[model samples]
Target: MSFETIRQVKKFTMTSDERLFALINATRYILDKKIDGSFVECGVWKGGSMMSVAYTLVERQVTKRQLYLFDTFDGMSEPTDKDYDIFGSLAKKLLQKNKKQEKSSIWCYSPLEEVQQNLSQTKYPTENIIYVQGKVEETIPETLPNKIALLRLDTDWYESTKHELVHLFPKLVQGGVLIIDDYGHWQGCRKAVDEYFEQNNISILLNRIDYTGRIGIKV
Candidate 1:
């Protein structure tokens, strides 16, 4: 797909173009490798990243697999002390803005309906799309797919990121793709991933995509 076309998808996402491109390629990679399972994204704010996956499936004329999107759809949840660095400052700012605005002014306040509308506009098969609206800590296990071909995590907090990995990573088929959107940018996210890997004895080398993004295949 042309960069211009990807830019259109980027409008619905907070991801950089480079990260978006990596997502597209990962979508295609799973398909090309004939990996069996669904595409899952945790922390789908506006649904742009998943939309890119949907677009890639359509562009490839393959639409059999399900697309699962999980989110709170009301901006970010509160970050704990474990979540520090840029993410911590940004969260504090958003909280202050919320108090001043007094109108739930949290970052990534995308409603489920709005996200549905955006994905529906892409001509991707609506039946193939699944939206789980709630905290990952609450909704993941019950709603997660049995097998995941591609797993993308962008929650940017320690607890949520850890929750996602604990529940979802096991379901990822051996050779499945895992993309972390905030590994280099958020201390909490990086800590969660590193801790998960350490606890699980996972030694996969995460390939860098720009400064914040990292991708690795499960062996």
Candidate 2:
């Protein structure tokens, strides 16, 4: 996308929350440090934040890094206890029954096609952004190519967060930024981060952005 296009998008676009904008600026600053790696977001919902990052990169004329987006294109996978305990036993039982009734009950969520269509309307070049579609567990292992400079994890489920942390954390660069979107909002996500960091013997300094989000910069 060109500078003019970026300005236009910024003009009519719905601005992100203050904390989100701060996080984006932090990401851009980290990317500006001449890091020898790429950018990636594990769970992109409607491509808003990721698109904003892409546009910022374009506006700054930063062309060396690739922006990779990984998502199921579907909302989320089946709720696992590691993430959905508060939903109550009845809700769990209902979900179980639904699962028994339908083999792909979770597939009812939005697909990647809609997200792609929305991106098509933007000036972000398709060449710079790579969309990897599939459940994180099934797609991440095969999709992540090299060390990442920026790793954003927005998966709300405990299993999903844990899976990504295990499979994708090692790929993050030394100075990479790891942004967890659901860190403070969802109990399951917080659990996953806490457990994973403990198990791996790695201490991350989490900088809480807001009530719903927290970020950790890998050093």
Candidate 3:
């Protein structure tokens, strides 16, 4: 996809242009290789990234793979001490704010309805699009496809990120790609991914997508 075309995909997502380009290219690679599985995204804030996947499918006229979107639609779930930014301030503030009052994170409070509408407006096949609304820790195992062609995770917390990799990563087929949106930017996200690899004794080259994003092809 051209950078101009990817810019259009960026409209519905908060992801940087380079990350979106990576996502688009990954989708294209999956299709070109005829990987057998569906596309999955763990955090669908505004549904932009997944929309890009859908857009690519439409542009390529490949209509069989399903797109699974999972999120807490209301906003971010409480971040544990393990979940913190690189400087370790953002998560602490969020933790403090949680204690003072029950409030969702303002940054990711995109509602399910709004996200649905954003994606539906794309005119992608409605039946092929599935939205699982809840914390990924709870919803992923129950709702994720049995097979996945591409798994893009942006949940940016320790427990949630770890939970996703444990459950979903195994389902990603050979030659499929695993994209971690916050692997480099968020400490907790990075920790979870590294620990998952260590615990499983798996080693794969993670291609850099800017400073914060990473793409690992499942060998």
Best by lDDT: 1
Worst 10 residues of 1 by lDDT: 97-106
lDDT (C-alpha) at residue 188 in model 3? 90
Cα lDDT tens digits for candidate 2, 30-132 = 7677666778887776666666676667667675567787887755566666554343342244455553323244323446776676666656677867899
- Roughly what TM-score does model 3 have, to 2 decimal places? 0.92
Candidate 3 C-alpha lDDT tens digits along 1-219: 557666766666778888998888999999899898999999888898998888888889877779999998877777787877766667757655653322234357787888889888667888999989998878868887889999999988989999999999999999999999998878999999999999999999999999889998999
Give the per-residue Cα lDDT of candidate 2 at 144: 78
Better of 1 and 3 by lDDT: 1
Q: Could you tell me how far off, in angstroms, the CA of residue 89 lies in candidate 1 after the best superposition?
A: 3.4
- What's the lDDT for all of these models? 0.86, 0.69, 0.85
**Model 3 global lDDT (CA atoms, 0 to 1):** 0.85
Clashing pairs in 2: none
